[model samples]
Target: MTHVMACIDYSQSSLAVCDYAAWAAQKLGAPLTLLHVLDEEKYPAAADLSGNIGLGSREHLLEELATLDAQRARLALEQGQHTLEKARERTVVSGAAFPELKQRHGHLVESLSELEAEIRLLVIGRVGENSNRGAQSLGSQIEAVVRTIHRPILITASSYRRPEKVMVAFDGSPTAYKTVQMFAASQLCEGLPIHLVMVGADLEDNREALEKARSMLISSGFEVHAEIRQGDVEAALHVYQSEHGIDLLVMGAYGHSRIRQFLVGSTTTTMLRTATMPVLLLR
Candidate 1:
């Protein structure tokens, strides 16, 4: 069975992610693990400053504050455990089996990567409402997790509502083929219509890629439509999605190094920033 790990934080966006994760787990017959990470270091300074009980002299007060910080870290771990329990219950009610709820007290990316050997997919929310306004689009947490985790990540924007129309951004790359294969094998888009779109400066290559992608999808028993568009990739995708009313956008992340994405700017990254539809990013 596919092992899906969902990063949950008890936020509204995280709840939406949980819902999508449950849907995916059910569709793929996969085992789901809801993971919650408590960054104990993030609270170190705050705990030391906030819980100063003034035990006696300056030295005693400092030691008391350090002890209090440790207590606070423990409390955070306990709270995260409780939240994961609730999330697990929600997943079970949503037609998924009781997922393994994991609570780790450490850096989010480190904890997640430690489980990479067991994880096939990672699901995360776009951004929490309480997050900083500027952080909503490609937040630090999302970026960090994506950069570190080699497993495919499904970033959810809102509660997924049975995708009826899925748009595949075909570039003829190996990773893109994997994305196509994933859709072909799963019931996630069983009765849904698929749109194979190839965007590039070269019209001939675009046409060829679209044809190849269409054939692939057709062979998988899907009613497929192909489109070849010119100009900027992000702009083309936005226009196509808007015109065709696409519910989900699928794409592959390609780059040798994280910094190389700066030059090539991954289709997944551009779509995450601009696309109106939810995106399934395959690595």
Candidate 2:
């Protein structure tokens, strides 16, 4: 069976991610896998900085570098294993049954790419352990990972609770319509109240698309609310979410230039970083 995988690092946000993933697994009745990727490129002790090693000292320096590299590799392996163990334990305690743990080496995205087919849903923290800045700045790999993976990714904010009210940011793009179709068919949002909203100047086109989506969702037994909001896309969305007590935000991962200007491209990055609630991005 496909699994719900949670990508965790040795960060403050990792536990939060695990908790969300566990809750998702329990809700979706899917097996859980806790993944921790060890990126060796992030650690570089082999580089020669001195630049002034005599022939006599060159052999010794090379030997020293090799030894250091070996030690670092060993330490990294140990740390990865420990992190996975803790993640598994935490997820299990959070109500996931027999969650699997895996540790992979190399770029995080590459590792995820290899495991993509097996992942039904991906849950990851907004930033990893390496992020020194606070929640305002996303992890270096966040954008790349989200753009590369076609699977629905749940970007965990500082905390998570199973959402009762979810808002979908629809822009009338093929991607947005497909997201509505998927949401209507999937058990992920089965009984939750959904708001299909579009932010634009014209209410006419927005109303048509929202009506179409609302009808489809209603046909599938979902309680759907359709609306058109005006103003800056991100600002309006966050305001609506806060005012309505929206616990989750769903939207397309990418869209055309016009919608991208408002929702998907760089604006998507900003929203993910600043959103107080979790975001589920569909491709």
Candidate 3:
């Protein structure tokens, strides 16, 4: 069975990720691991500019700051633990297995890599509160981990409602096939409606490819639908999703290297930045 890892924080977005991860794990009969990384150095104190204070006084103030930092870290850890426990309880009530909780101290990306061999998939929240700026945005840790992790990553945006209509962007690539196969076996897509969409400038071979993918999904018992469009892949996808109310999008990440992604620009990257729907990116 597949092993799915969810990088969780105390945020509501992370809770949403856990909800989806729990459902996905149950569908695949996979074990789920809820992971939290505690960064002790996330907050830094300013240097004491008041030179009037004696060295002993400065040392005392520094000690107090250190104690406060430790207390805050402990509180955050406790909250994260409680959140995961609640999520596990919910999963158990839903007939899914309770997920294991794992806590590590260090960089989130490095810590996740330590378990890369064991984790088949990673689920993470789309946005988080910025520690330094105090604004909501895509967390740097999540972006870095997604680029670095070799396994497939499923990103949850707001909340976890079971995806009923799933759209796949196929291009006949190995990564695309991997996504198709993964969805075919996943509980997320089992008996769910699927839309197999292929976008290109022309219909040369895309029509045939769409038919092939449609057949595959239909054979698997999905209410399969196909679309072949001519336009920018991202634009066309966004239009289609908005018009049809697509719930989730599955696409292959198309780039051999990071530099290639920059030079040619990937469809996956475009959709990641622009698509409002949740995306499942397969490598």
Candidate 4:
């Protein structure tokens, strides 16, 4: 069965992600999997702590380093296990029935890619344990994971409530149209009020697409509205979200071409960072 996979790290936002994942799982009638990945590259076994040590103590230093590495591995295992247990308990308390817990060791994106087939949706925080920047900047793994995994990802904020109103940033891209259809068909956003907003001066061309999408949602029993504005995408969407009281933002993730891989789309990244509420990215 497909499951909603929530990535849990040592970051402060992990609990929020878990709770939101539970809510999503309940809504979709899918199980929730709390996944914790220990990326070995992020944690080194040993650092060069010996500053100008004499040669006589070099053997002892090497032995000590080996022991320290073993100890670090042990601690990491214990911590990951404890974290998973807590997350499972939290998910159960949050109304998820029989949520699964998993801990893996490797690159997070690679691990997630392998599990993509079984994952219906991915829940992750905007920032992670390695993030040194404030909330304005995203975690390093976010881009890679979003690009690598084909599943829809719910980029969670520090907190989440069941969204009453959802806004779709429509740009007439194929991916965007697919996102609209997915939202209409999927149980994730069913019964929510949806707003389809496009930012551009070319309303003549956008009207047909907007109307089609709006019609689709309406047919699916969604309370749908469409609007068009002119300005920068992120700024326009932010204003609309604030003014209209948007509880969730949904959009297609940027494509993963070589150029895009090297230079991530600024609009998506910036909007994801600046969004006050949760953002659902469909790839």
List runs of model 3 lying over 4 Å from the truth.
43-68, 131-137, 185-187, 215-223, 255-266
Per-residue lDDT for 132-240 in model 4, tens only?
9786567888888877888899999877677889999887766677888888889998888898998877657788878888898899999988999898877899999
Worst 10 residues of 1 by lDDT: 255-264
**Local accuracy of candidate 2 as per-residue lDDT tens digits, 1-283:** 8899999888888888988899889888999998988776864445553565676667667768767876787788789889889888888888899888888867899999999999999999988888887874677788888768889999988766778899998878787889888878778887899988888866677788778988989999998888898899889999999889998899887766555653344667778878888888887
Best by TM-score: 2
Candidate lDDT scores, in order, read 0.75, 0.84, 0.71, 0.84
Worst 10 residues of 4 by lDDT: 255-264
Which regions of candidate 4 deviate over 4 angstroms? 42-60, 255-265
- Cα lDDT tens digits, model 3, 1-283, are 5488888776667767777887778766789888887765673333343454665667667666767767777777787678768877766665667678888767788898888987877888776544332222345565577777888888776776777788887765555666677677666668777888877645657677677777777777788888877787678888888878888898766533331372135655556656666788776
lDDT of 1 by residue, 144-193 (tens): 77778887778886566656788988776666677688767766677779
Where in model 1 is the C-alpha error above 4 Å? 44-57, 128-130, 134-136, 182-187, 255-267
Going through the candidates in order, what is the number of backbone clashes in each?
0, 0, 0, 0
In model 3, residue pairs whose N, Cα or C atoms come closer than 3 Å (at least 3 residues apart or on different chains), thus clashing, are none
Candidate 1 has an lDDT of 0.75
Clashing pairs in 2: none
How far does residue 237 in candidate 1 sit from its true spot (Å)?
Answer: 1.2
